[model samples]
Structures are given as C-alpha cells and as structure tokens.
Target: EEVYASQPDGFVDPDNPNHVYKLKKALYRLKQALRVWYDMLSSFLLSQDFSKGLQISQNPRGIFINQLKYALESLKKYGFESCDPVDTPMVEKSKLDEDKEGKTIDPSHYHGMIGTLLYLTASRP
Candidate 1:
C-alpha cells in the first residue's frame, strides 16, 4: 500500500518538479490510514501471542462474524445496555417531524450513537 503526496509549497525539488514524494507515515483523517493502523495493531498483538477471536454467530448458516459481546459492552459503556428494547432500532422516517424551535442535541452524543449503530450493523447480512 503505497501513498504519495506532492511536495510542500516551498519545499519542491527543482530537479524533479513533477515527482511526488512517497509517504513514510500515515496521514491524518484518511480512511485508508486506519487500515494501516489496524494492520500495525494486529501485528503487535500477534507478536505478543494474543489470539484474535472470530466472533462468529452460533448459527451454522451465518455468513458474517458477529461481535455481539463487544457490541453489548459498548452499549453498556455508553449507559444504554439496560434501556428498553424495541422491534426497530430507530424511528420511522414517515413518522418524523421537524422541531425548529427545540433544543439542539449534543453533536458528540449524536456521533456516538451513530457510531454504535454502524458497528452493530456491520456484522449483519
């Protein structure tokens, strides 16, 4: 996985003006950079003799591995573990209504909830 970047504004090489510099480290905020980080982490874990869990479903017909325990732990960490369960995880779009004058929710909290849902749904078919 090679990544390249153009030379900085004042640091361009006169001799090779068109040559882009190869990245020696991961750049911040790029999605592919996360893969590099995960690879590094998995390598370190393997070196330390830590076994990775498959987290597969108990059902024989399941295709994807489910990280149920981790998801439950995350929900508990966010104080939502014991909250009332619902047939649907979110509200129906058709039943939605705008509240222009209502108080705004915290951005961080909203992001956390969305992140949790993403993790939970990733393992589903």
Candidate 2:
C-alpha cells in the first residue's frame, strides 16, 4: 500500500490546488507501516534460515529482539555500569507511587529514563 503526506514548506503545486505528494517510503506516523515493514523483514529473514525469537505478548503479537549492546550502553549511561548485578530488578513487595513531596528532577531527564526503561520492557516484560 502507498501513503502520501503534505509536501515540504518550499515545495508547492501551482496547478493543482489540492495536490499531495506521493509517499514512497514508510513513515512513523502511519500506524500500519511498522507492521508491514516488520512482516516483510521477518519473511526475508526466515527465508535466510533466521528463526523468530520468543514472542513478548500474545494479544499484540509483539516479538523480542535481543539488544545486549543497547542494554550495556544503557547501564553505563544510567550509572549502573560498575554496580553489582541483582537477581531481581524490583522487590516483590515494592510498589512505585507518586512521590509528590520528593524533590523534583528535570523533566527531560525523567522522560529519557522512562524512554530507556520502556525500551527495556520489550525484552523484560
């Protein structure tokens, strides 16, 4: 399937009032493009004898791709490099709650941390 989006700011059509540029590639905003690309790539990989790894969840049909390099770099980036490894990330009784009284950290920093953790969840969840 093909998708089209508005042309760049400098590019305009004088002849066609409602003309839109044809999209030749997949874009992030297109909801189905990711799945389409994933299926296409997966099919090609399977043809080359690459087996799919474990699926992360059943409902969404998400699959996990190993990211040892990313994990290592993330650990280093978050100052967990030299820290001792633990058997579990969180304690069974531990619960995360809103710390309304705690000192507020930078919003960007917190968001970056959340983004990294979100990526980790693809494998760990």
Candidate 3:
C-alpha cells in the first residue's frame, strides 16, 4: 500500500529527485528494498555532505549496504551461503525470544552468530 502511494513507474524528477519526489519513501514494499533504500539514503547523505559512515564509490542508487563484500564473506565463512534468502528481515510484528526449555546451545556459537549479523548490518540500526 505504501509503495503504491508514489509517482508512476520509473519516475524520477531529475530536477530535484530528493526534495520533490522523495524516491526513498516509496521503496518500502519493493523487492530488495532494504538494499535499495540503504544505497539511496547513503548516497543522498553523501551528496548533501553529511558524514557518518564509510564512503565507497558506487553506481547510481547503489543501495543496500548489506551487500558489502564482508557480508558475503561472512556468509561463506559461516557456511550460510546456501541459506534461503528472504525478502523481509523478519515476519511482520513477530516476537523472538530465547526458549528456556529448549536444548541449550553453546554461548560461543550464539555469540558468533550475533557477531556475524552485526557485521552484516553494517550499522544498519
């Protein structure tokens, strides 16, 4: 619904894409939107001379910081390269928590997963 409330297809007001169209807001429901949005926002910030994170040379709308080489490397490092990729980060409004009664896992492994995800986020939060 949100994604539909925007300009028509392939719409980009070259005159002032950011201020007039806000192409960023319309990407929510898109495939690989997380990546696209990230790329656009980062580029926008850089264009505006706003500094916060690493600056990498990129293609237009090269969104999605999660696509970093390190992220892929981490996936291969952790043997998750073949894992099914999901469009959404998590199910909508889903609750996640530790299962106290479930079989215990090694804390180190848990920490490792956390570490890997943190790297993947690339300051996502």
lDDT of each: 0.78, 0.74, 0.66
On a 0 to 1 TM-score scale, where does candidate 3 land against the true structure?
0.34
Q: Tens digits of per-residue lDDT for model 2 on 1-125?
A: 77778766667777775788787777776897889799899999989965554443334666554656667777787778898866987778887899989997789977887898886776663
Tens digit of per-residue lDDT, candidate 3, span 7-70: 4557866665554433435456667588778888989997996544433665787743334565
Model 3 RMSD in angstroms:
17.9
Q: Would you list the rank order by lDDT, best first?
A: 1, 2, 3
Error of 1 at 19 (Å): 1.8
For model 1, residues 1-125, the per-residue Cα lDDT tens digits are 78889888899899998999888889878777898899999999989965453475556675566566666777786888898876987767867779999999889988988886885677453
Tell me the spans in candidate 1 whose CA falls farther than 4 Å from its real position.
56-125
Winner by lDDT between candidate 2 and candidate 1 = 1
Model 3, residue 95: displacement in angstroms? Answer: 8.4
- By TM-score rank, best first, the candidates go 1, 2, 3
Q: What is the lDDT of residue 54 in candidate 1?
A: 46
So what's the TM-score on candidate 2? 0.36
